[model samples]
Target: MRPPCHAVLPVIACALGALFHATQAAAALKPAQLAIVINDADPDSVAMGEYYRKRRGIPATNVVHVSIPGKPRSIGVAQFRLLKQAIDSKLGPSIQAVLMVWTAPYAVQCNAITAAYTLGYDARQCAHTCAAGQPSAYFNSASKRPYTDHGLRPSMLLPTALPPIAGPPASLAPEQARQGAQALVERGVAAGARSLPASAYYLATSEVARNSRAGFFPPAGHLPAHRLTIRRMTADVLEGAHDVLVYQTGMAQVAKLETLAFVPGALADHLTSHGGDLLGSSQMSSLRWLAAGATASYGTVSEPCNHWQKFPNSAVLLRRYLGGDSAIEAYWKSVAWPAQGLFIGEPLAAPYAVASN
Candidate 1:
């Protein structure tokens, strides 16, 4: 038997409101809770670490340096285990998340670096890289400190994708790379002041399979009239949308990206396979959103189980962020199967975080 639509609305609203208030009371994770990992062998990684540390005011002791080489793109499980042990030993138990500053070695076998760190190096997590492995402990909880509440931590990658700059090094010039990385942190700080308006665009595509999660999008009229604007589109993509704070849709690849504008601290992502496979050629990379100026984004490194339930729910993400959760926290909470998804961008970008404080 199914409940009537009207009867379900209040229950849903109540649940969301309770989640919002509970999370509102919790503080966003601080820079002190993060342990920054830098690959000493890569100058670009080192520069990024330095820049992020200075910009976020991270403590010197919290920076952990490792000698992982910058090639091969993936490391052996045993090698990654050792690195994890080293990080755990150096940072102790106080750390709640890790910020890996290098672009290379993003995967440990089939597990993304962020996934491996947060959930540990389990071959099961790798066995089905496309499928959902496990639910994250930090999802939708009132706990600000992941280690304290869930006994599991969360992680994110900085400089997920580098800008195109011709250089002897060829990947990204050190200064240019640092600027790109620092932009994320700066935007997060700026979001604290509400310098930009709160808005969201939910593109409900005509593709039936892709739009399976469209039912989860919030009603446009229900959003706070003054602080936020919600737009629901029945097209493939929205055009000329400016200062977009949150944009979500499902498609193989997003089109007309150049015409869309993203404000600093904006959260944008499209549900698609292989978007999280940062270096793969199969589909559009999740890094495109970062390149387009969004502060944070999410995508699956592999197939992601192909069920709408396994993917992020737009309503949960928007409500959590509107209620003061950090970008990483809100995004993490919205997904039922996060083990396969790689959350990339500024972990601490919290536009609504200011209101709570």
Candidate 2:
């Protein structure tokens, strides 16, 4: 009972094996084009920001530091406006993409922080949860210089992937989460430029509402030209896969994620009302994909009401990824209405790029 296609990033691998090795080719999103935002209040944010900045070779001028006394889950529009102003004031002209380090504050009102920063805060989206939000000019576009072409800089969050608030206890939770974010950065660097022999799994679950985008899954087959394979399955879950590049499904909480291994620069997420509610108690958060080894993942901060346009179109996502777009670019272009969706992961992982690095 799925309708048609459509629809939107922290992340780059799972096990790091022969299935996906280091790449050497080209990347579209260069280090100089990226800007890193660090929250001085949160220690993890500061540490991961420093590490990712160094690893990616981001220019010193492309860094912005802000202080939020309390790292709340969602900030008020007034506060976000100031935050956005602070960030915008510091970014240089060459900056095209932004990486906000930290898991909390992923949303502003109902709009995801990433969308709010890149597209400007839209109060209309917060006015209605299920209504259509603003359309992105960059959706499915071929523009490489988003900032220069459209005055928008696509943003992604470097999240810890740890279950928010109530989850299993850990002795060194902050340190461990910081390490997790760093590992994600490493995977992104390793994914730079490589021809990956991978598979994209599209699991069609019985959750009819959640499966609205299932029809848009890439035709299940092999593409020898790209050295990629797409699998459209009728099951609710996949098991024992060694090379998972792109995984899209619809469920409140997915099962058996730990059993699979994801290739570097992987994209994985579920479609649901609150998957983007990273700190909310109910339903699984999109951060689980990162913990499960996915490099980038997406989830809606507010209820999207199963609108296909609000989620990432698997067809466009795979096409952009195979066409050599970075994880952030491909993910951002796939979502037409993304004000409510949070894009999380490593933003610059481009495993398929053929350009000179």
| Per-candidate local distance difference test | 0.71, 0.81
Best by TM-score: 2
Q: Candidate 1 lDDT (Cα, whole model)?
A: 0.71
The per-prediction CA RMSD against the true structure, in angstroms, equals 4.3, 5.8
Instruction: For residues 143-194, write the lDDT of model 2, one tens digit per residue.
Output: 7889999899999999853642236424336667666777777778777654
Instruction: Kindly give the stretch of ten consecutive residues in candidate 1 with the minimal lDDT sum.
Output: 1-10
Error of 2 at 199 (Å): 0.6
Give the C-alpha miss distance for residue 87 in model 2, angstroms: 0.6
For residues 63-93, what per-residue lDDT tens digits would candidate 1 score against the true structure? 9998887544678989989988887888768
lDDT of 2: 0.81
